[model samples]
Target: MEYELIDNTQAKQYEYHIEGVLAKIEYIKTKDKIYLTHTEVPKQLEGKGIASSLVHSVLEDIEKKDLTLIPMCPFVAAYIKRHPDWKKLVLKGINIS
Candidate 1:
């Protein structure tokens, strides 16, 4: 499967897509952090790891841009918890807050 990130400025959100299936992600930007609020991968796309892939891609972007992440989305939080090495990319205080 192929994934792409689209910034939906009109909706004030970012979206991940695998073909035509869209995964909605809510984000809030602070001076030094990007907080991922919520994520939803359609039921038809469940169990296929699309959400994981989307989270990975978003994290990659964060790293490349030298931005810290506040993973408010449960899926993203769990993903960071699983990858301790990536914990370095998380913004301080925001993790617990």
Candidate 2:
């Protein structure tokens, strides 16, 4: 499944609304980097692969904007681990362990 990742800059998060619920990845943006700090998907929507999609969208957006990523959220970190190609989008000099 695919969804548009809404970069709600005013909310400091990327949002996706599906089935009338909001799924979001919160971020903190600096001049050259964005710290993906948390991910939230309602319990009713778990186990549906939505979180991975959200993370992918956020990573793609960060890459398009040329901003480094700091995956502070454990969920985002695990997603990156599973999708290693996206590691190139991470901020340099930071260990995501």
* TM-score of each model, in listed order: 0.83, 0.94
Error of 2 at 40 (Å): 0.4
TM-score result, candidate 2 = 0.94
List the candidate 1 regions with Cα displacement exceeding 4 Å.
Answer: 93-97
> In the order shown, what is each candidate's alpha-carbon RMSD?
2.2, 0.9
Q: Could you tell me how far off, in angstroms, the CA of residue 12 lies in candidate 2 after the best superposition?
A: 0.5
Model 2 ranges with Cα > 4 A deviation: none
Residue 33 lDDT in candidate 1? 81
Model 1 clash pairs are none
CA lDDT of each candidate? 0.80, 0.90
What C-alpha lDDT, on a 0 to 100 scale, does residue 96 get in candidate 1? 38
Residues 23-48, model 2: lDDT tens digits:
99998999998999999999999999
Q: Model 2: which residue pairs collide? A: none
lDDT (Cα, tens digit) per residue for candidate 1, span 12-77: 567886657778788887677888899999988899888878788778877887888878888889
- Top candidate when judged by lDDT against the true structure: 2
